[model samples]
Target: MSRHLLLGVALLAALHSAYAGGKVLMLLQSEKNIDRFSSFTDALTAAGFTIEIKGYKDSSLKLREYGTWLYDDLVLFAPKAEGFGGSIDQQTILDFVDSGHNVLLGVNSDVSEAMRNLAAEFGVDLDDRGTKVYDHFHYAVKEDGKQDHTLIAATDLVDSPVMVGGPYKQPILFRGLAASVPSNSELATVVLSAPGTAYSHDPKKSMIEPPALMVGAAASLVTAVQARNNARMVVAGSVEMFSNDIFNSQVTVNGASTATANKDFCVTLTRWAFQDRGVLVASNLRHHLLGSEEQPWGYRVNDDVEFLVDVMEHEGGVAKPYKADDIQLEFIMLNPYVRVPLQHDGQGTFSLRFKVPDVYGVFKYFIDYSHRGYSYIKLTHQVPVRPFKHDEYERFLVCAYPYYASAASVMAAFFALGFFFLYHK
Candidate 1:
């Protein structure tokens, strides 16, 4: 019946709705394969997302119509389309990412100039001549000594729980040929690579000069870009790598003669690409003195303060947050004055309590927490530390106070003796 109570109830409902809602949109070119699109859509949906697939050929489709807000996420599976069917062109897609939304670009051996241009925009150089990757030493071998270089098996994956599947039961090995450059961009992180034995070339023709790009030294298979704005993008050299057939296929690597399923690798790669595994989120951040209820505007020299942050996976389940030993903190000015490991409280909180240094100046509590499969967490809280106040100084030093009293008494004695001597004389 009260207006204030009604307002409070309305605010709670709005908060809940915002937290519980999210959508995924897929934009495809006319020639895009139905199977690949369907598989990706199904995976996202199974992950509890509401997905909508649209074709660029649709007459009503226009990137400008949506302006800066087309979709929360975009999937570009139509690499061969010379241009988008909608008003959305290459520039429009770039703008979408610039505005902070996720994008997935899947390029196969049949990479087009348009696809290469897009990859270049993201600082990736796909071999223009359509070179297939070949690894004689690491390729899948048959009964004969010759290697099956076409369907090469790669297991030299980046040892990142976030990039690869978490603690794979068996090694995730893939038998396919894809080309990528070495991990070079400061903004991008490489997830998969061709083994040291692998190299890219025109597999149809015989070698002329030593291959242009060497394996292990100059190629990547799968690379992920996490922009400064936290917009995520995955660039893969092969699209069929995520197909149901490849996902379910099994292979053997090295001396393991028996062939096993390669489904694990496919599943792991998909999870990493679709934002499944490595999703670090900031839970709680706080700063306060050791024994006070109040959080001060600044700290005092040698004051003990506790810095805490709770990190957890974004997906809901029974997963635990960062363990007691899994977090770290930095007391930084320009560089870190102190880089200390945080102890967890056994609950969800990872915290560190340390005394402020006697030095006084502007300093920041910084935590750059990036786990392998999670989103990166960066936090900085600035607070200045002042020299101790006069009243706050230690009281009545035994040695110094005695010295002060003796000096005062000596002065009084000299004055009294002078007065007496003058009067007596």
Candidate 2:
């Protein structure tokens, strides 16, 4: 009976693992070859994600009907989406993603206006319908020994481990459009960028008359944004990179040819987007008196307090501390009264010691960390601040002895003068 029970428990655990794997919802073009995404699907499956693909025609505006919450990620790869059917408009998808779910958005030259509008709403400025990004000088050479100027070899990857993770074996292939993210957007960060020789224009048009709309490093080939709620969105200018041919293609620059980084790039990108990696989870936050780990409902002014947080970064498996650098802490009233750098001891715990300000009021310990390509981390702990106790006040001070003596002498003289005046009267 014990053996049977153990077997039953093991079976249940396997079933749970299958159900708990990341689920994906992909909206693709019905006209395109479905086999084109065979490798993409395989990669996702290898990463433990179950994918569900539906054509725009079949997709419904009623996203809840398809269990949006049930899915962990959404991939919008419909470049030629003329219009969405049912109630699944741009806002519907955005609202779904805004609920702390992730999305991987891909666009092309034939990108529909609806898709462009959606990109704009996310602060991603995509090029016009017919325009494309090209590097006149750095274009990849084709297998035919001819330069394909339109197939740009983008080498400017952002220096972020949470995004790219490791050294890419080769540059990613960008054969599509370009975009720009709002400069003021704290959530948006460029993941891939075109080289200084790149420009955006309509290939069919006369190039001599029109200036390049986007030039140099200003052209954003790919970008990612982490919303205030820690939801991530990865926007790519090209969908071809996910195709099997491109994923396996060799990149030729000048006279040299080597295997491309397309496959690794896409897989890593998906992992980051799905929050399997580059996700920071702060838990088990504890703050108390420096010496006594005792936590009180409130704290006294001028007390030395200590703050500690267990900050772990999530990657496919167990979460561990992202002990990269100094995290920040702020003691805030109406305004920030104290700001200090948190130190970690090579463990998951981050801590800092600071003296409570003499001025007492309601305050909060605020920790806001905005790491690019990672989820936003904001923690606020409220603890009221009370003034020092009556006994806490100084009874005597060497510096103030002169002032106390002068006050005593003035009182003595006042009494003498009062007696003299009474007697004379």
lDDT of 2 by residue, 213-290 (tens): 478787899888888887788889998878887887776886679777888888888788887777777887888997
RMSD of each: 4.3, 4.7
Q: Estimate each model's TM-score.
A: 0.81, 0.87
Model 1 Cα lDDT, one tens digit per residue, 211-283: 6665663677777787766667778776656656555444445765544234555445555554555556566
- TM-score, model 1 to reference: 0.81
Best by lDDT: 2
Query: lDDT of each prediction vs. the true structure?
Result: 0.66, 0.81
Choose the strongest candidate by TM-score.
2
Number of clashes in every candidate structure?
Answer: 12, 2
Measured on C-alpha atoms, candidate 1 has an lDDT of 0.66
